[model samples]
Target: MKIVSEKLAQDQFTQLKLKNLKTILAESIAQADRGELHNINDVFASLTKDKHEDISNSNI
Candidate 1:
């Protein structure tokens, strides 16, 4: 009984430190829709070339 309680406590602690991805993504998407997300990707894109630049030339 004591061991089970200890394991449960450990699992709860680990879970607390883990991310809730669904909640996080929902919040991020909501913020983006509301224009609250900073969305600085364009700033970084200028530093790199188009990722799909070779897509058109591919033989696939």
Candidate 2:
């Protein structure tokens, strides 16, 4: 009986932690969206730069 209570308490704590983590993640995503993060554009530009460099090297 005591062990069962302990397990339940642990489960509740874990659930609470997960809920907090989810809230934090949601807030982070909202902030990123508000900031208009350009990670994708940056990645595309970097890939294009690399391709250009490759082409230049090949020509040389």
Candidate 3:
């Protein structure tokens, strides 16, 4: 039935997403072990600055 097929497709998609997430997590752990990291505050500050700049540019 269509419903069964749709469910199977959704399950496959979920599995794929989980696999991708696991891969990303492993890469992140490896990067951390290599001392490749950023400060959270700095990241947020950069984002905030960029957002403000975007708003100012839009007003022009």
Candidate 4:
């Protein structure tokens, strides 16, 4: 039981950390957009996102 509880706790912590990271990334992008910051990594991340849409699909 102790091992299971530890695993659950670790998973929860990992989720929270990922959520925080996404929030920070969004804030960094917003700040960069406003000209309040300059970080190439953030800029690159924003630009390199997968934007491929189903534009070729006839269903649309």
Compare the candidates by TM-score and give the number of the best one.
3
Where model 3 places Cα greater than 4 Å from the true spot, the runs are 39-60
Winner on lDDT between 2 and 4 is: 2
Better of 2 and 4 by TM-score: 4
lDDT of 4 by residue, 1-60 (tens): 999999999999889867866877788878988997776776446434422232335346
lDDT score, candidate 2: 0.70
Better of 1 and 3 by TM-score: 3
User: Cα RMSDs of all predictions?
Assistant: 13.3, 16.0, 9.0, 9.8
Instruction: Write down the TM-score of every candidate.
Output: 0.38, 0.59, 0.62, 0.62
* Deviation (Å) of 22 in candidate 4: 0.5
Give lDDT tens digits, candidate 3, residues 4-47.
99999999988986786676567666766777746545334544
Cα error of candidate 2 at position 22, Å: 0.2
Q: Alpha-carbon error at 40 in model 3, in Å?
A: 5.8
List model 2 lDDT by residue over 20-59, tens digit each.
6676556656757788554655434544675698699999
| Ranked by TM-score, top first | 3, 4, 2, 1
